[model samples]
Structure formats: structure tokens, C-alpha cells
Target chain A: MSGITRDTLMAFVDGHLDPTGRTEVEAFLAANPEVAAEVALLQRQNDAIRTLYAPAGAEPIPVRLSVDRIAHSGRRRNNRFLTQAAAAVVLVGVGLAGGWLLRGNADTPGIADRLIADAVSAHTVYVLEKRHAVEVGGDEEEHLSSWLSNRLQTNLAMPDLTASGLTFLGGRLLPAPDVPGGKAAQLMYEDANGERLTLYITPRPGIDAPRTELASLGADTALFWSDDMLTCTITAPYSADKLEAIASAVFAQLNPSGDGYEI
Target chain B: MADILHEIEDAVPALRRYARALTRDVDRADDLVQDCLERAISRRRLFRPTGQVRPWLFTILVNLYRNSLRGQRRSGDTIDLSSIPEPAVPPAQPGHLALAELARAIDTLPPEQKEALLLVTLEGLAYKEAADILAIPLGTLMSRLGRARATLKTLTGAPAEPHLRTVK
Candidate 1:
């Protein structure tokens, strides 16, 4: 009580001092005028701060800021992410199925299998529709090539298959995470009967396998071949011989130099 | 569970008051409270059933506010000093005028001092509770409160009466 420190005085002002200590401080304050005045000013400041902003607490709480609403919204967001993840898995499964159908019994397809799977699945979904088949049609081949090449992050030339009784029907970009660039470009072709075929091409660097493989899964036959530069998977319902002939034409046209084209 | 929500609902006004005083911004204060409540509700299973939820919620709110301040600092965003509204000039009452000056002075303090001052003064929290919420030692909390008051005294100007008359 005799030695009233600043901490003790602050404790008194803040109501932290116990009753016995409070009585002691009160006695000290009675004896000390300057200290008591300071404490009073401190208390008033606290009062003023409260008066200025305390009304905010009394105002009605907005729904968006409510605890219940925030929790509910968080739950909804988590549910949506889970749904999207599930859809991705299903899409991958469909892509794998398409690969298996096209390359019936190829020894080992590697990344080409994946591209074929994705391309066939995309073709199956979009080819059935007469309209909305491609974002950029075959009529705009130069634009499609540049746009798809930019998106897929590589140089892509639209392969001419007119000699194989198929005409360019256009190309679409597909997500191909398993591939090197996380993207694939599928160029579609249509014959006189409106029968369709697709070439799934992606930049290939890390893939270590043979250059030629043919497999048939269901309705589609796929011929997968790769050189040092790129890998292409030709997926169609055509027989293996027919697909190989179309693939040779596609290979020569896609790589016009003939240096990268085998057979 | 319903009882807990109801208790939190009852404490919301007080929490908002404390948060607004802590943040000095309406939207930021509410965001802090919302984050605190969501964390509390989700982690209720870990909460001791017998423990009071009020102090826990306050702890969470304070931590979130501190984290946000740290983030803002890293991003190099200027602290918004202008957002704190100036206190209205009260009618000719001596205490009211002093209080208005005090409010502006509080806004000028370092964040730690301001936080300590509000917890003890505005929220009327016990020294121990305030220290616990701030994660500071009791001695540190007392010192901060002491420094805050001293700063306010200087900024708000000396009181009218110079002497303390002994009351019977």
C-alpha cells in the first residue's frame, strides 16, 4: 500500500485489483491527487471509445454475415468441389474405355492409349450431333490449327485424310492431364457415309515404347504410332488395315517433311 | 447443441462490440467474428463440454484478427487509419469532452496497447481473461494497460481538478 506502483494503479483503474488491494489503492488515491486525476482521465477515455462504436453491436445483424449462413455456405462449397472431383474421375474412365475399344490387343499403348481414350470419348459424345460438333469447323483449318496449337502448347497441323475417303471435320481441345502438356487436340474427319474418325495428337517426349500398335476395343479401331517428335492415335470403326493406311496418310500430312513419317 | 447456439447468439452483440473495438472497421470486425464462430462450431467436439464458449470464441476472434493483420503487413497494404470515425463533440460537459479526446487518442496507440486497453476497459474482462485472450503474460498485460492509460492521459490533456480531495 505504501509503494503504489504504476501496474497497481492501472489494475485499480481496470478493476483488476482485489477488494483488499482496491481498498489499499483507494487509500493511496485519497493521498495522491495527481495519480487520481490521471486514473479518472483514463476511465473517461474508455467511456468515450465505447460511446462512439458500441451502437454497431446493437444494429441488426445482416444475413450474409451471420454465423449460421457462413457455415451453411462453406458446406455447400465443399459439396460442389466433391461433385466436380467425381465428374473428373468419370470422364477419365470414359477416356480409358475408348482407348481399350480402339486398341483391342496392342501389347502396350502407353500415353497413346490415354490420348486415344480421351479422343474417342470426346468424338462419341460430340460426333452424334450434327450441330455443335466443333467450336471451330474444318472450314477454318488455319484458325483451328493455331488456336488448338496455342492451347495444347505445340505446333499442330490439321492432317489431310481426303485420299482416305475422309474430309476434315474440325478439331477440339481436350483436357489430358496424364499427357505431358495436360492437354490434347482431337482432329476429326468424316467420310461419304458421314462415318467419323479422329486423330488424337499430343507432344511426346518422355514416352519410351515401340512406334506401332493396333488394338480394337468395341466399335473403334485405333492405330497408335510415334516418331521422335510427336505421337498420334488414329481412332475409328475402320479395320486395322484401313486405319493403318489412313494413319500413314495422316502421318505424312501432319509431318510434311516425311523425315518424321515412317512408311 | 441448440443451447450452445443460443448462448453464442446471446453473446453475439457483446462479441461484435469487442470485435469492432479491436478492428476499428465494421466489415473486418464482422468477418473476424464469422470466422471465429465457424471454427468454434466445427470444433465443438474438441471443446470441453463443461467449458464456457464465450471466452473460446473471443480467443478465436483475436487470433484471426492478428493473423489478418500479419497478412496485411506482408502484402504491404497501408493500415487504414482514416477508417476509425472521430468521436462526436459532446455538449459542454467536462467529462464528455475529455472522453472524445480519449477516443481519438486510443486510435493513435500501437495495436497491442489498443487491444490491451479495450479488453480491460471496454469489455470489462478480468486481467487474467484479457491476458489469456491476448496470449500475453499477466505482467505484460498490466504493463500495456499502464502504458495505454498514460498515453491517453497525455493526448487527452490534463483533467480540470489538480488535487484529489479526501472523501469521508
Candidate 2:
């Protein structure tokens, strides 16, 4: 009775103690009326909590909460055929809109549209590549940066994503017909799990657009931000909030001269 | 593969119960559970053969919950308690007062304590499993559980005063 610790009593009440330990607590409680009452109270509280919420488990789970159903439906929705069909529709729509919008401007595509297109294209191209995804591997990051900057005609810095658990995977140069130089820089990063994310950078398109536009295309979310000199698009399968965190880090590194923007 | 999915599906009910108790809202709880399941399914390849899926899923759920909390903190959105649909139960029964008091006390507990306590008491997880889920040492988990129960006893007007005298 004297040696009964509070933890032993608690484990006894919660049914966590082994039989020998529980018997010791039981003997202690038999001699101590107050300890018995406290144990009883704890039991009642546990019972009350179970009574209040355990019915939720007993209730029929809604169809939407079904994991198999959700996974199956999501897989169906993300199927290559359906995705390609959807992408075709989106591309045709974007092409039509881009044509109309370009007809009005005669010189520049909307920066948001261009960035989204560039992101999806980059994601599709490199996600499929096994051996040569990036022009320069992340191991040659210094050369990757200077090369990308020279190609894009802008001062580009490779944002370190180690804090986000994503390591640099290298970068490449792409055609950005919407930009002044008709070129863009794509920096790729892969997490420890090999989930790849890419950042598409182009010289600023000279359009006064919103500082941030978060858009979802298929399974990927694109977070687009424009500073005075460059517009960067971060495309990943993560949620906007996750992308926001990564984008904030990317922005801090990529735009050393500009005031930090909320990613 | 399918067996793992089936096992995960079986745990969904308990996951929902735990999440509902944690969030106090059905929709939010389901969203948390869904996110947990999706992450678990997608990452099953990374799961070790020796690793049990339940604890791994719980870990994912806890992390997702923390992340959501961080987002909510940044957004500064206030929850309108009135918007939460009340169950069809009538006025307080003999035990309702104690349950309500315990609920408020739980809301007041730090997130770490609440997470640890719920994994043990509410979900009935083993001490080791709860510790693993919370990524804490076994002793730390026990201490948190002890503290949580003691605080609940005091807050729910349990017989702690007399018990403290006897124990000391």
C-alpha cells in the first residue's frame, strides 16, 4: 500500500498494468478508500468519454470516408487515359484562350497561363525521365545556376530545399516563347522519398499580374509569384499550403534583393 | 496490397472516432482521416515489412493534424461553436456534467498532452504504440499520460484531493 505510485494506480485504472502490478494496485486500493474513489472517478470519466464519442465509431461511415473507395476513385480519376483526355481539353481551352488573349495584346501571353503551361509541361517531361531528367545534376549545382541564369537572361539562384526535406536534383533550360528571351530555367528537387518538384523560372513577362496565384492542375499545384525581374512557378503534388512553405523558402533565396513575399 | 488496404479500412472507424474527439467536428475529422489514409496508401511502398501499419497511419494523421493546426493558426480563422451540429441527446444526464467538464479540460491541455492522452485513453493504444505514434520516449509518454489523468481528475471534480492526501 505504501509503495503504490500514482503511475501504477493510473495504469491499473487504464487497464495498462500487468496482472502482478494490477494486483498490487488492487491491494493498495483495498486499504485506501480515497485512492479507490479517485480510481473510480477516473474510470467514470473514461466511461463518460466513451459514451459521448464511441457512438461515432458505431455510426455508419459515410461513403466519402471509405479509403478503398477514395483510392479507387482517385486512381480512376488520375488514370492515364482520363488524365490525358482532361489535359487535352485543358490544352485546347488554353490554346483557344491564349489565341484570343494574344490577339488582343499582339505581343505577350498572360503570365499566369504561360507559367501554368510551362509547369505542366516540365512536370510531364521530367517526371518520366529516369537517366537524364536535368541538364545538370544537382551535384553540379554551381554550374547549373550560372548556366540557367545565362540561358534565361536573368540572375537565377538555385533555392535550397533541404529544409523542406527536398534536395536539389538539378536544372535545365526550356523554351519560354512568352518571355523576352524565349527561354526558361527549370530547377528540380526530389524529396527523400523521390517525390520530385520543379521550379520554372522565366524573365518577367512585363504584365502587371497579381503577386501570387495558386492554381491546381490535375494532381499538381502551381504556386506562381512574380518579382520585378523574374516570375517563378513552383509545381508539386503537395497541397497549396505545403507549396506555400516551399515557395517562401524558394523566394527568399531566389530574390535576395526584393522584399520577401508570403508563399 | 489489398490486404493492407483492408486493414487500413478496418482501422478507419477507430481513426474517425479519435479524430472526431480531437477536432469536435465531423467534416474536419473526416478530412484529417482521408489525408492520413491517402498518405499511408501512397507511401506504403516505403513502409518497412516489420513496421505495423496502424501506428504508421496514426503518425501520419498526427502530423497532418499538426500541419493543419499550423495553417489555421496562420489564417487566424475563428471557429463558431454554434456552427458545430449538436448530437440529438437531451439535456445533461448524471454523467454529462463530468463529460462536458472533461471535454473543456482536454481543450485546455497543451496539444502535446492532448495528443498523447487521446492516443492512450481514448483510442486504447498500448503504451509502447502510443509512444511510437507520438515519437516520444516510453517514460515521457507515461508521464504525459499520468499528468493528463491527474489534470482531468482535478478538472472533473474527482476525488483527487482526498487521494493526494492518502498517497502522500
Candidate 3:
């Protein structure tokens, strides 16, 4: 009873005291009506607080607050910043390379050249956008894969570029006036240096197009590869070798049948 | 890595609950939770995989809430305590405290005391754990809780008086 203090009374009310401490407090409270009433009021206050707000924990969580989604978006933002410096250097180098490569083939402007132009153009415009870079974010990969596959009329598996230090930012559907289904899917990816790569994919163009072409134009490199079922133009600021490396990883995943361009 | 995320995910409901109590507004509470989750997940590489995620998350939430309050103060936007919506009344039960009055009193408590009291009472955290989350000594935490409770007791005097004997 001599050990009983205001702190002990509060611990008793909050259920934080040990059993012996609790027994001591209980016996002490039995002897003191005023202190007992105070403890009871504190306990009631705790109950009232819980009653007012505990339902929030039981309510359905909004999707924006999902741990996985926040984690995924956070990764994307970090990727954007980490690569920003390296991407700047690479972009300047590729921009110089891209200028000459496109001029030599401009006279005829074949399907391969046209698709590469569209792919490169899309890449240049979107990579600079801080927001609105993609129609759906990469967190919705499953929905994106299925929706894109349906829209393009071909199976489109979002390639795992994490192996290549690339994070998928997501995809948007675009008009492909030069290809069948008149639709194209642009899948954007970002490297750690904040440099962006875009895959401009369309169902194999009905007219004859080159099986493969590598073109470097103004700060962007476009590597075009076509199989019987689909054509993909990969545009990024990376070198021909780097693009080739990513291309194979993308090719294997995009066309798992293993019949496409052998790296 | 996956384990840490799963741990973080498991703590979301409690984080939301604590945030709800702190902000007393649905959208602001969730926005706070989202910001906390993003920060926790982004900086998780710095977090030891072996540490419990709940206290870490509570620490982040508490810091973010404090920073936001400071930002609002610097911007000269005073929080209108009167603007806090009335709490949803639970059905009356014998010995139930007045919910709205208690909420108002809690809103008016000094931030540190309110935080210490809620961590101990509402979240049911162990006293040490609550103290650690607040980054205060156990003695300091106890004092804050005492002050917070005594203030609440005084503020809710009328509703709580029926059962108490007059000290005189």
C-alpha cells in the first residue's frame, strides 16, 4: 500500500502493471473510494477513445494505400532519380548518333524506318514527363499484360527487365496506322540512371518490313525486330550493344516460343 | 525483402487506426498512412530485417504527423479545433464515457501527451514500446500519460462526476 503512487494507479487503469503490482493497487483501491473512481474514469476514457476510432482499422483499406503498390511506385521514382545523371550523358551521345542514322534511310522511308521513327518519337516525348508517363502504372502489371495483349491481338507478356536494371513504368495503347489491327502498345521502362526505354510494339505490319534493323537517331536508339506474329521497335538512349542485350531478354519473354531473332 | 514487406503490410491496419485517432479525419488519415507506407517501403533497405515493423512504422507516422503540423504552423494555417467533426456515438451502455467530449478533450491536449496517452491506451502498446516510439524515457512517457489523463478527467468532469464522492 505504501508503494501505491499515481503512476501505479494509471498503470493499473491501463492494464500495464504486473499481477503483484495490480493486486496491491486493487487492495489499495478497495481502501480508497476517491482513487478508485479516478482509475475507473481513466479506464472509461480509454474505452471511449477506442470506441470512437477502432472501426477505422476494421474498414476496408483503399487501394492507393496498398503496401505493394506504394512500394512499386517508390521503386519507380527512385529509379528515375538514380539514373538521371547517367541518362543525361547517354542521351547526348545517342542524340548525335541518331541524327546521321535516320538520314541515310529517309529517302525510301520503309515500314521499318517509319516504325522506328514513331517508337523513337514516343520515347523522346514521354521520357521527359515527370507525370503522365504511362496510362497505367507498372504496379498493375497483370491487368496491363492482359489488357495490352487483348488490345494488340497478340500475347504480350510484360518482360521482366529487373535483370537488366530496368523497372517497367507501364504501357499505353497508341494508333498504329502502318500496322494491322491499327493499334500499337508502348511499354515504357526506366534504368537506374533515369534513362528511359520504350518498346513500340504492333502486330506484324501487313506490308513487307525488314526482319531487323538497328537505327540510332537524336539521343535515341531504335532497334527494330519482327517475327511472323509481331514487330517490336525498342527505343532508348543506350548503345547498340546495350539495346541488343535488353532486346534478347525482351524477345525471349515476349515470344517464349524461341523462334524470334537469335541474339 | 519479401518478409519485410509482408511485415509492413501486416501493420497497415494498426497504422491506419492510429493515424485515424491522431488526425480525426478519414482522407487526411489515409493520406498520412500512404505517405508513411511509401517512406517505410522506400527506406526499408536501411531497416534491419530483424526489427519489428510496427514500432518502426509508428515512429514514421508520428514524425510525419509532427512535421505536417509544423509545416501548417509555418504556413500560418491554424488548425480550427472546432472544425473537428463530432465523433460517431456508440450506443449507450452503462458506465460509457461521453465519446464526443472525450474526443474534444483529447484534441486539446498538448501533442506529446496526447501521443503518449494514445499509444499506451488506444494502441495497447507496452509502456516501453510506447516510450521507444516516442523516443522518450519511460519516466517522461509516464508523466505525459499522467498529465493527459488528469486533463481529460478535468475536462470531462460533469459526465464522470456522478460516480465520484465529493473530495470535501
The most accurate candidate by TM-score is: 2
Which pairs of residues have clashing backbones in candidate 3?
A83-A192, A83-A193, A83-A194, A84-A193, A94-A219, A95-A218, A95-A219, A98-A216, A98-A217, A98-A218
Fnat values, candidates in order: 0.35, 0.38, 0.50
Cα lDDT, model 2, residue B164: 48
> In lDDT terms, which candidate is top?
3
Model 2 clashes, total count: 0
Per-candidate TM-score against the hidden true structure: 0.53, 0.59, 0.57
DockQ, Cα level, model 1: 0.15
- Tell me the lDDT of model 3 at A191: 90
- Tell me the spans in candidate 1 whose CA falls farther than 4 Å from its real position: A67-263, B88-101, B159-168
lDDT of 1 at A255: 70
Writing each residue's lDDT as its tens digit, candidate 3 over A98-187 gives 344344343545677667766765677677887999998999999998999999989888999999999999999987777878899999
The model with the greater lDDT, 2 or 3, is 3
Off by over 4 Å in 2: A75-263, B80-97, B159-162, B165-168
Model 3 is docked with a DockQ of 0.21
